[model samples]
Target chain A: MATEAGDNATLKRKAHQGRPVSLMRKTVIHALLLGVCLVFMAPFAWMISTSLKPKDQLMAPSPTLVPQQCEAQIDGAWVAVDREADDLDITCLLVRPVGTSYSQVILPDMLHEGYELLQTVDATPDRPWAKVRERLPGGEFGELRVVPVSELRYRAVPQWSNYKEVVRHDQMKFPLFMRNTLVIAALGVIGSLFGSSLAAYAFAKIKFRGRGVLFVVMLSTMMIPFPVLMVPMFSMFKWMGENQLGTWLGTFKPLWVPMWFGSAFNIFLLRQFFKTIPNELSEAARIDGCSELGIFLRIVLPLSRPALAVVALFTFMWVWNDFLGPLIYLQNQEQYTLVLGLQAYQSQHTGAEWHYLMATSVLIVLPIVVLFFIAQRTFIEGIATTGMKG
Target chain B: MALKDHNTLKGLAFLSPWLIGFVAFMALPIGLSFYYSLSVYPLYDEPAYVGADNYAQLLWEPDGSGGYGDALFWKSLKNTGYFALLSLPAMMIVSLGLALLLNTRVAGLSIYRTIIFLPSIIPIMAAAMVFLLFADSQDGVLNAMLAKIGIDGPDWLGSEAMAMPSLALLSVWGVGHTVVIYLAGLQDVPASLYEAAEIDGAGAWSKLWHVTLPCISPVIFFNLIIAIIGTVQYFLQPYVITNGGPSESTYVLTMYLYDKAFQYHEFGYASAMAWIMFVIILVLTGLAFWTSKRWVHYQGE
Candidate 1:
């Protein structure tokens, strides 16, 4: 729709337009858009800011926008502490303090002891200290200087190495978790996709008897809460001599075997996407001397790339992020996925040193976020358009 | 004759994978679970043919504790049902409203969509952590913000009265998927219908009621089915946020089953509970589909 200018612009050109209606509309729309944008962006802004603030600020009665500078005795001499500066710099005043925990004290505590905080050199959570070389007594405090920079050059410190430390924190190492996650997700994607695609193709393309009823029965399984199945499924697996995999495959079949059967949601999505393909293509393939297998591999498989991608992406995500599945199925920590590893990380730390836990969470989520960015359009379309033909 | 035989063989070959998977993985396991539900098969112990004891215990036993005990099973089902009931309607309406608001001819609509979808991308564990901070009863961001408005906020995740509702509200925060679905539905509502409604002197409310709602009923139906199924299986929010605490108010069926099977190792009774839940979901979904003939309007129909 074009901006209607006949009523408002005609009056404007007449030089007697008291109020510009279109302009008012534009202003109102702009303000509304800006307000919504703010609401959307607030959580992210809060996360970043809260991460930077000291732990005390996180639970403060009245929250402070920025941390306050405090003074304390650094060495024998007094030194100043200033947090607002971009580059943290410390000026020395007195000699070194007797206590080794001098770094633990905030700059404001040092300054209150009569030491002026010249500047804050660094206030990173990784390195909380602001290094200052204070002057001896009777020396001018003016010559001593501290500078602060806003940017925390964490990369310069190469805290990425701490990622390794995070991994090795307990039995829940990143490499082991990554290996398990990749293995399980790979098997799950292959199994579920293979099974679901076949089942979906039958439901969508085949003109078999009882196809509709079977499809409805299959889709109806979607309503069964997984927990409802979890208990029974475990008992069945145990009874099926799954533990006997120790003698056969030398590993439990619980990891990947279940997906060889179709999952209700994936089958529904694949079936819907499959049905959108015209039957004429399959019929034409049959006329061209192609068998059903040939038609599936040559015509249908190649035609269903987008749907396959959606299926694979979703399977990868669900299986990767699945905590309950791994928590139940996998017995050994060696078999744990990344979600299990995160659980272990939290349990190991028991809420102590939240920074490490948060840091590890950031590491874990980064790859998933990257994957989402890469295939976001398809992901959104895959989910939203499932209703188009239903 | 050989070529004709080969063609039939190929058809069977194409269909073999699904047939094999269905029989081996799904049908066998499901059948076995049914049998096990009739017997007592405790993990790390020999199975015993205790004919209908597990089911009976689930139904009539006032003595048994945990999964077989009727109180816990019924309580969990009630809690889970309560969660689904409160969250689904609120989430659907809020999502539709958001979709309608974003559907207006506004610039940066993609930005709004991205903002709304942001929560879905957040790892559930991370979101739980954030909510822990935000919903802290004493000095939380939620309570502090409310203090500014001169209204004292009650304990959200802390009190039994508010825990499940708090979890339900948390579910709505990730209603991004629903909003996207509604957007697709709104797009399909043919601009012509709105124009015709306007031409017939229908105001915005009347136009929405007559033109918009009817047009999107099928999409709403689709979302409703998916939402109900998803909510019934809800575990992560309650598991992480409340830990099924505040006197087990947020203890859902899934959580109960999980604790039984994994934590307590009561395999036989847990299996029975699971089977009952499966039957409940199956009947409910069947009923929904059966009733859709009346309300769920197809475009051609």
Candidate 2:
């Protein structure tokens, strides 16, 4: 494919020969790309931001990406208070009048004798400091008070320890989940690389009576959604469990053991990659009296490192991010993967504490993100080939 | 014949692992699923043959005021249909546009590609958590941002009217995978084709319409088929984000099938539902391929 620098230069030169690309066009192109990137990247940024924030600010309207510590003085002591909307239309503010429990939204200018002036917030949700609470002797919250916006102190105090706290959480055995997930991932990657490569080698190189038919049959299987087989597969595993056939139902076997067979998608991908390697190499090995398996191991497998890496990475990813399989197969708490554990954590402790949930999510996704950076070219090429080479 | 037999033996030996897996996992299950579809297999007892009563009940009770077969069934089908209608085009167009932009000689292409690709690759469960936070009706970042500009945002997941659309919005956010595929297809287009179009005095828009789209039509077809198959069995995100909430507006086929199979333990009925989904995918994919003959141009074929 003419897709490298040479192709780019020739296309750019020939397509617009009379006029070079203008600054206006470049700026517009960049502007569009930036907007798209912002949409794509904002959720990740927000996820990490919400994860590191304190529980109090978890539901703050117009939440900030940065963790903030803004306080105001009420009853002569600084306290944290939730603010109303960041709308800056009206004059004056609402405060707990130091006596009544329910404070009124009042005009600050109306009270002449005991009223003090208060500054309007900076018209951004970033500066909502209207409410105040008393910081008691041992760092306990005393009361919720609506404070004047005046004399408010603000600082970016990010709760970077949320990651640590989530790990240390009682209900979630983060380390145990990590160990289980890694165990499954390791088995799955091994199964896929060995199993899919061998099958792909057969389909790509060897002549069989029904090879074409079998290959198409395998490709067609890719179109069948998991839901179609979800029930009967469950029944099959249940039968295994009922007959005491080596713990298929409630064990990791149901999840990772299937990969020891061929995956249609990975087999297809590797077969394409295998065919691209010259057939003469295998012939030369054959002439040297190498067996079929020996040629596959010594020549084909070593030469197809990139394809194997792609297969391994993809298989690892599927195992890591798998939800439905774990949702059904694994029964006990001790058998939970990170994704299942996260869902269980959410269902157990719903809504109020999102910091922990988001933090747990980030923890689950962090390894895949790291792998992407480590094998950037392989990941990109592998993904692109799956779609195009089809 | 002798040589063929020898090669066949070796090839079958190599493929033994996959062959064993297929018989156990796919072929056996599919056969049992069909058999179960005819019986009342509720896991507690041995499955009694109930004939096609499950299918009859599901289909006859169209309760047309609702989903595909029964009321909830029809509703699930319609909901999935509505989602597929919105998400497929939105992802295709946006990803194609972004791919075209990226295909141009741009500074910092890798940075943009990374940003775009990372979201699509993240765990769907994690992405759902983000959407859950970002789309909260009252205190969500989306509503808050809308409020800043003096427009109120709707209750995204909380409202029946907007729940599927909210999922669609999230779907668009992860269009990076499709974009990468499109970029690969675009780069594969020969530069000489563009040069020829230029010499023929075709402008940019005409050239894009005539030359570029035709070349990438197969990629589009592939994306459409994957998206359709995916949309018909949409789960995970809706399960995590909305849970078919706000009056079951986001109740999709797979979710209902899962509930029937796992929750209610009605393995037989769920198998029927699974077969229905299978038929839907086959018909839809068959339609795409049938239509592709007109629009999808294979250059060397």
Candidate 3:
């Protein structure tokens, strides 16, 4: 019994020793995962950081992620300082006669807009102060003040105005581009759902003579690289513009119109989903005097909401993010999508204006990121299902 | 027979939208592209017949001396091939490794998955902007980080030698989607196999080799084909970031085709190039499938 007790104590001791090892393992795993997460999130964080930075700080010798507030030399040390109120009178160090006493005095009727020296004055015993000028609130030059020489410095501040400047930039009309993109994406999603669902219903349920052959043909279109069709498609659209649409070249028509015809992938996804629904429901609806269209609208469509959501979400993302289509079709700046406008902004101002450029990029990507978060499940499901099937 | 005929008619009615779209969009363009490949069809002009000339000029052009005018076809092909070779295996390995790591029971796994996958969803143009900011020579965050480690970072997108590799690095950053797909594949691997391996005294590495790999080989094969096709048609990254610049070192085939068709108005030549790309993709895909039979193990097969 004593030996048994000793063994039990030893076992307890061993268990107690094992805890730290397991904890060490957990710590290592967490550290690795966190490290990987940091690498992945670094770029996005950089974008946001750059977007918040002031123009001067953007090209600093060593850029920092967090935007720093303005600093001023105070008491012989650089320190962050608040801007002097507009209503306050400007103060200056005034000298009376050469080698006389220096006094801190207010320059009356002068508001501190920003400090600059107009001209240096040679001081004599009679008029012993150096003359400096301060620019007032307006562009008008203020009277020169005779004062002792003092250093002036501007503090670095986060430029929240960069976002405004980006949106209202002269070259790129960001709001208009966003409107065009939204219109195209919305219509594309609607048309894709309307057209692809109809086709998917037919492919899933309707037993046609050439159904098998046609389905295979439609699926095969997914394999065709876009570059192969790019030339002819361009020619076709150009021809169509000249002949039918009265100039569809520099318009949003080409971007969304093709979507109205139903994409192959969407049709495949919806069809696969539609096939899983019990045939009895549609049959009952048909027996109850519902037409095929009626059965589709009332029975199949309502039941296939999740699948349809997946299609709509994915289509929305594709249309929103489409760069090549807009680049090929939209010639005029007014018809440019957000993606095209962002590219134009970057190309026009390559290295400089990074803050504004990043601001615009954030504007362009924010919606998609938000949408992904909201419909995260649908995205994962759609990707998983499509990937597995492919 | 009449009822069957009626059913066929109804099915055709339902299929009309896709049918019309297929003919107008897919079939017609495909046929027209082929015809355009064989003809000199500049934009806004009727195509002139030039049978096999475009093909011969592009394919048979000797280096530095003869054939087509300013033929960078071989150069672009080499660059694209180099990019695919470098990026494809790297992406697969990284994504697969991430997938395996995430497959373990860990805290905040969903958040980790979401964080990793987030980059893939960002628009390529926007992603390019972010990459450009981080990759800037002097003041870039990446260079700053490298400086802390006592190494000077090279100009990522600026230098010709590093341009394609920089794009590949960007590609790896957006492997979140690939990783997610791989995670799904890993999930489908039955736990019983792993348990059985463990019971048989198999270590972690051996279990991965013996059980995990074979089960997920099909997924890997699928991803490989997809990645190849994607890399072959790669356009937006180079277009947005490099614009096929620094002496056209990063110029892929698609960018070449885009320039030919849009910039230079060499529609026929571009069409030929597109067809060549199409054929290359087909052959590569076929090769992948043929090779998959040896290694891609299916459950219950």
Cα RMSDs, all models: 9.9, 6.1, 10.5
Query: Where does candidate 1 stray beyond 4 Å?
Result: A1-43, A48-73, A76-168, A240-253, A278-288, B1-12, B60-69, B147-151
Measured against the true chain A, the candidates' chain A TM-scores are 0.66, 0.78, 0.74
Tens digits of lDDT, candidate 3, A268-347 = 88887887778899999888999988988998899889889988998988987889889998998998899999998889
Judged by DockQ cut-offs, the docking class of candidate 1 is acceptable
* Candidate 2 wrong stretches, greater than 4 Å: A1-19, A71-152, B61-69
User: Tens-digit lDDT track for model 1 on A244-295?
Assistant: 5342121335667767766767776776666667788889989999877677
Ranking by lDDT: 2, 3, 1
After superposition, which runs of candidate 3 have C-alpha atoms over 4 Å from their true positions? A1-25, A71-157, A244-246, B63-70
Task: Report the C-alpha lDDT of model 1 over B1-301, residue by residue, as the tens digit.
Answer: 6765664455345446666765655666667667767878777786677888887876776654444447877788899999988998899888888777666665677777777876776677666666665677875667887898998998999999999998887787778878877777777677777777878899768977898888888888888877877777788878877888889899998888778777888777777877887787777777878887887666654
lDDT of 1 at B127: 63
Local accuracy of candidate 2 as per-residue lDDT tens digits, A82-101: 34433333454544455455
- State the DockQ of every prediction: 0.29, 0.54, 0.42
Best by lDDT: 2
- Candidate 2: tens digits of C-alpha lDDT, residues B1-301: 9989999999999999999988888999999999999999997667788998789867875455654457788788788899999898999899999988887775898899899899888888899988898889876888888898999889999998899999999998888889888888787787778889989999879888999999989888888898888888899988988998879999988999999999999999999999989999999999999988999997777
The 10 consecutive residues of candidate 2 chain B with the worst lDDT sum are B60-69
lDDT value for model 2: 0.82
TM-score of each: 0.78, 0.88, 0.85
> Ten consecutive residues with minimal summed lDDT in candidate 3 chain A?
A1-10
